[model samples]
Target chain A: MSLKSNVIGALILAGCASLYGCAGQHSEAALQQAGADFQKVKEDSNVLRIAPKDVIRAGESLARADRLSTYWGSGSDVVHYAYLSQRYSEIAREHTTQALNEERAAKLELERQRLQLALRESKLLSVQQQGKWLEEQIVALATTQTDRGLVMTLGDVLFDTGEAELKNSANRVVLKIVQFLQLNPKRVVRIEGYTDSTGGKQENLKLSRDRAQAVADVLMDLGIEDKRIQVEGYGDEYPVDANASERGRAQNRRVEIVFSDEKGQLGAAR
Target chain B: MAVLALAGCASDPAPNEQFRLTEQALEQAKAVGATADEVPEMKLAEGKFNRAKGNMADQSFKNARMRAEQAELDARLAEAKVLTQKSEEQVNVLNTRIVRLRKQLGDAQ
Candidate 1:
């Protein structure tokens, strides 16, 4: 035999032996190729890329399907390729579905923020008018919060001398309060009436009751449901200040507006 | 000769093609206010799709395969994003028009 033929035969025999001796070595080279290819994939976009792993195992139960699709002899390779292709397609589909869902969630969040901004702007405009009115009527006023709810000071203008009858000038404040209540219907209220110590306890109690009922009645007439109201008359017992002088008496004879506002999901819908 | 021929078949062409397709998908992501960082998630997804495709190609090459099917999932994802962006644009335009018309009507009234 020629030397060239002999060398070729030896090399072929040795190469086959080495290839068999190192059965899993091909996978190391495959991994290297995959890593190099993955680097190229990362440079394609500034976005970080995760190396695609051999996730056929990560896929749900590929063995049975792989066997079923693959047949021996004629068209066996065709069926095998088809089987693997289907698996890769399925995995790709799962990733795509996850991505689409994320996109949808992001869009929904953006829409929510935009709607909230619009709502806030409208509320701001409405409050601008109310703020002007509040500026005029809110002289010497203070605000406080309790377990009961937010309390706003309503001056002594809502009542008459020793009588709970609504004063003529109190109509504006009454109507404004009614409008405010109507705007915020998802709220509860308690009206506490008080009187100066100059009045007897019984008379003060009666005056306080009548005044509270009058305010509650106005609110009811203004379109607030009756169930939302709780009225009480403390009269002279709950005097905010000592009735030693006219100024103290003026302060004592007043109504306290208490609201019990809880954020309830009555009809909040998505 | 066969190895060299196969290597050179679409080496440079493949990178450019992938970049172009990825940019196309990124533009679709952009319309939805995806930050530049978030926008490239599509490319990452496409890279996975590409790897799946490469594995599929390798399998065919080794097994004396008949024909390799190109994975269409990345393309489909890109297309879906494009359609989504278009629909969102349409909705935004409609909302703007509605707001404008309402304002005009209020002024007229």
Candidate 2:
């Protein structure tokens, strides 16, 4: 064959070969895609992993959070986790409770025994999973900007008027917080307690420091790694706004959660 | 009938033979000098999975599962880029490579 003609033919062959290679890639890709789609359907169309136990666990988590909010006289993340974590938590509780009940009753028929075991195992997994989701939310909050820390005001809400020590009702709130800290710990949790500008700097700082310490101590008591928590007294510093009014000061009297600055850590990566 | 088929055959692309100019834009936003946003490719992968799901939602269990799996794959792949990636280079490479491949394919045709 002439050189030019031979080159043209070879190019055609090469083109077809590449196209065929692409076709192969496409084929496998298409199958993988199809399989993934099928899996989604199976997941969505299937029972969707609903468990009575999980629902119960989620309810308990929500109820506990609510009890905490009422006792603290402030915000509760109950509504939030209710929507997000309830399904799994409920499933966890139902299975765990049922398994315990059966064990107590000593009435496990052999046929039902395997199913009970499976439910209990799944319950444990679901609780573990729900805890993971709670961690993710905290991590997301920690990384979010300061104005949006999903933090509760530590002053009026957590303690009685002008009190640095936790209120009787505040104990539940502190315990809930301790649970959160224990489940989702990563870095130093700065409990920078603040107070209204109603007091002098010395008294305010002491109150702030005491309140922060009170909360920190609870977390420590709950077996949180003490080193992971840092307590500070911001003492009306960086007020949310001018302390010209009740609402303004109420907003200011809060404990802050400051994530370790990502700038320094990430910058050090280079 | 044969003549009509011949006329239909004269269409420029044979439809299958002609490929569109496919280009994707990658806006690599850094959180802190990290090229975390392998986001465009991730979106496209997600779209592919979505399309797969749409096309095969009623086909069979295996097919639907596969599509969902691809969605997770794409999601995970995008997430994987968040760590260990330099801010701009990886995205630039992907954007340029896809375009270059398209051009070469056209030239061949």
Candidate 3:
């Protein structure tokens, strides 16, 4: 063979050897990288516990890459297998992250629901306790719990025989009512005044109205809001006792206070 | 010659599909308030997705595929972050409501 032709042949052989060497180095590097990625995924605590299936797949892909690298040298198949192994490891990591996040989210959701239930229970207990307290206060005020809410009666002794001004003895009962109203700002009340059938109809009605207004004025002065009180007079109407006897007439001449329901709704006076 | 042959034969159309999927994922994350609550992760996802597109334009199919995969994962993480933050806000609002209700009960007592 000619010297120049021999030199050309040797150069081609060198180029082929270098190309093969480069391919082998590339495959070896890929395999090493894949092994490192798989080891990283296996070492992660969350991935090990929550992503077992993905970890196993990554392990299997890594094993396949190892076998392919040993059998195929620097072939494209070994590089592809190594790349697949790396992808599998990354997928395992992603799955682990998603699982951990979902677990944390679920825990938070459960905590929120628990807090909601606790708040609801506390609110219910508070309402029940308030209801019991209100009942006791009404009882202390000498009131009756009728369908028309709590009704308390003040006899003629609480006022002068012919005047609308409240007597000194009426202060205690009025104070009690003011305290109850203060305790329940949402509760409204109505003051109803009544009288026996002795005076002229107009004069009796005016006296009754003036007496109801006097009670309401005292309540307003004691810090009760004016909007929470209604005043009315029913002269000799809906009497609780017969007005023929003196005792019955005394009973008829009285003031009645009616408390509203929980919603602050008062019923019609009967 | 072998390098040319390998490039011509092994060029995958899969990177195109992966790029499209990553774009869709980013769009979905943004639609769900990811930009507001998950700004850092959303930005990372967008950056990686844009880089993937640049690689695709440059015909670096392998780099494009890897970047697209990473972008998809980041976008998914952003979506998860947005959901978690929204739930956290709901819990805060519920706590405030409970406090107000308790105050009303105290006032009544």
- The candidate maximizing TM-score is 3
What lDDT tens digits, residue by residue, belong to model 1 across residues A50-86? 2133133212122322222222221233233333433
Q: Write the per-residue lDDT of candidate 2 for residues B2-101, one digit (tens) a residue.
A: 4533443343221111111111111221222222244553575456555545544444333333344334333433433443243234444545555555
Error of 1 at A200 (Å): 2.4
What lDDT score goes with residue B50 in model 1?
A: 55
lDDT of 1: 0.51
Question: Could you give me the TM-score of model 3 versus the true structure?
Answer: 0.52
What TM-score does chain B get in every candidate?
A: 0.44, 0.35, 0.83
User: How large a fraction of the reference contact set does each model reproduce?
Assistant: 0.00, 0.00, 0.00
Whichever of 1 and 2 has more DockQ, that candidate is 1
TM-score of each: 0.36, 0.34, 0.52
Scored against the native two-chain complex, candidate 1 gets a DockQ of 0.03
| lDDT (Cα atoms) of all candidates against the true structure | 0.51, 0.47, 0.73
The parts of candidate 1 lying over 4 Å away from their true place are A1-142, A145-148, A262-270, B1-109
Q: Candidate 3, residue A68: CA error in Å? A: 9.7
Best DockQ goes to which candidate? 3
Task: Give the poorly placed runs of model 3, Cα more than 4 Å off.
Answer: A1-37, A43-129, A143-151, A154-190, A195-201, A210-232, A235-254, A258-270, B1-14, B36-44, B58-63, B77-109
Docking class of 3: incorrect
